[model samples]
Target chain A: MSSLGMADKVAIALVLLALAGQLFFQSARRRAPYSKLRKVNAYQSADLLISAVAEKGRRLVLGIGNNLTDQGASLSGVAGLPLLKAISRRSLFNDQKLQTVSGDGVLACLSQMVTHGAYQNAVAVELFQPGEAVLAGTTRFASLAGLLPEVNHRANGGVILSGQFEGETLLALDLAARKNILVAGSTASLGGQAAFLAGVCNLALGEDYYAPAASLETDPAAAASLRAQDLLRIIIAIALLVGAGLTIAGVL
Target chain B: MKKGLPIAVAILSGLFVLAGLIFQPYLGPYLGLVLNWAVIVGSMALLVAIASLIIYHARSILTARKGFIFSIVILASFGLSLVGGLWLGVDNPAYLKWVGAIQRPLEVSLLGLVALIMTSAAVQVFRNRGWSPLTVSFGLSAIFFLLIALGLLQTLEVPQIATVIGYIRQLPLVGARGLLIGVAIGAVMMAIRVLLGSERPYSD
Candidate 1:
């Protein structure tokens, strides 16, 4: 304990609790529990986009904004990776295609890898198009600007804006809305959540709420991760309530 | 070994960084070096990414794809900017101006678009609401914010109205700050998962 601060110990304890929770849920299969994650229409819209692409042979556009690195809040992009895996697998299964644009080159590269793996896992590696993931400049507007015109071309099925979006979110959301394309956005950026609430048809709001992949239960690993996240969230919420109550009682 | 080595490396490096950040011991030097290495590795990844990008666009141009013109433009811009940056150096005023010429207009256009979208969204706010209590609350709050933004509320000659707007604006601020904490929690959760090898984007 001397090797780390008190706060670090708290963080370690919490992570262990999360790991424990994940294990508990996975082990107790007969007594299944449900996560209290609210209904996010973005998951439905994502599912719809896959079905639409299959049914109509239309293209799906994926916008993973400027957040790509493994550092800091960029994990929001990583958090949304399961959706990409799911969509890529579905597209491969249905013999449809999807295009991805990213503000970060690293993200585009990783996304390509993810898509390739998804196709390979689905046993349709030949249909995997390596060129679908494009790095549309690092600048916020530059990325959106380059992708806006591309959407006009490939947008027939739908578009899902995921990852980290900030001030330039409205442009992408608004442009997608203008095209009358079925659009949904998922991100941890408060700006993204607000923009989606205002313009996009569906949304996954807070980073805490990116539990879409948990519902699918296709990947046990992802389910376990979601269980951990939900457990942590409940703990935090309870702590907040307790703190608030204690403060009211002049004991905080 | 392939998977095990990567996950093992990730967890050790992650722990080192975390411990250094918290403890500030001799391990801090190693943590700093690891971070520097991370940045160096990230920079190298950019080169690979660009090579892949160039290949993709080149194929489109070569195959005469429908958007091949855009591909040409992309390649040309990339080539020119790279050459100019090398020739003039990134810090040169001329190089900066050259890049800004490409950046400024796009930024302006996007901001203008956002403003238009915000206006349109506000105008059509109740179109789908069907007069539910929730819709009414949302619509009223939006209008209240809009009135404050437009200086319409200040025109009422009531000082107390300004106070109300001030308090109202802070509501979103407080909510945003709360969301920031939520974002931090989510980030920590994700980082821990990555470190534990429970969430491996790199692993197939």
Candidate 2:
């Protein structure tokens, strides 16, 4: 019954291992529909956006969703790098231009991944121009405003907003929709409010932002991490149920 | 060494931060000073971004691009704002008045313009994808609407409805918390990967 007992530590470690294993197997199989219940909303959105870009021959616009360096967690920014890589590869394969914009330095690191991804996909480095890959904006609204015109004029086939979006995402999505561009979005924070007003986009909530790379690349490490997350969720749920039952029985 | 330097710096800085957190009385002052340096670096980065914007836009204008006029306007506004803020002081009455006069109206108008755009976009979404796509969209949408409704009703003094809605909203917080805890564990593993040089963000 001790709070910091060996049993609890061992149990938690086992749960994490189990989760990692699940993710590894699922990613390796590549048969897991982006989610257990349904397709992961973000992956579905990315797929839809990619298809639209491929079909329309229009450029894809990706917003890293963090306008302030201080506002987002470092982990969210890191997670976004892989997603940017995957999206950039898809853009290159389709011979579509991928325009990325960042609001902070941490978010800007994603440009490296986009560049590498484009190169790995055998897209000419010249064609994958630096200016075309990453643009930085000063303020949140200013970045949204700057990207709005680009979305409107570029005839963007698809728009992907993932990372740490705020009120600006709704504005960008609204502009994209007006241009008849397909848009998909996800935010690591609760700012998914913007996704609601924007309407009918593939949006990921909280940790679901991590689902795309595993789904797309089937990378073993990423798969294992995702599996760990799933198992952790189950363990937490069981713990919650037990706590509730004990409380109800007045045993605590 | 090039790749290792960043990871090494990250570890040292991370340790400093942790020490500050755990041993605040002894290390707090130094951490505070370090954080100030972080802010200075952040400011430098912002300056770089602004400079890039100026260069990009100037080139576009010089080349007589289609959006040259707008670029000019942006540049002018940016320059004037910076000069005014610096010379007159942002807290000065004149500068405050200028901001008060311009900012709210500009923001309101921008919001209004985007509202119209949102309406058109929503109509287009319906026209292109129909109700099925609408129904299957992100769960965040439902949460957003619920929160907005709850906020509005609470302001209107509807306590009973607001209370119920608030509790329902809190239901997702539990799941969100669980997800966060899971993510924290994943982050630790990923950090270990980076520290062990298994995952390199800088390398191709």
Model 1 Cα lDDT, one tens digit per residue, B120-145: 77556567325768568878888777
Residues A149-169, candidate 1, lDDT per residue (tens digit)? 767875356888778877557
Compute DockQ for each candidate against the true complex. Answer: 0.51, 0.23
- Candidate 2: true interface contacts recovered: 0.16
Model 2 Cα shift for residue B138 (angstroms): 10
Q: TM per model?
A: 0.88, 0.75
DockQ-based CAPRI category assigned to the predicted complex of candidate 1: medium
Q: Rate the local accuracy (lDDT) of all candidates.
A: 0.72, 0.64
lDDT of 1: 0.72
Tens digit per residue, CA lDDT, model 2, A80-111: 56667776666665666677777665455446
TM-score of chain B of 1: 0.87
Where does candidate 1 stray beyond 4 Å? A1-13, A30-39, A70-73, A93-95, A122-124, B128-134, B150-166
Lowest lDDT 10-residue stretch of candidate 2 chain A: A30-39
Error of 1 at A169 (Å): 2.7
True contacts kept of each: 0.47, 0.16
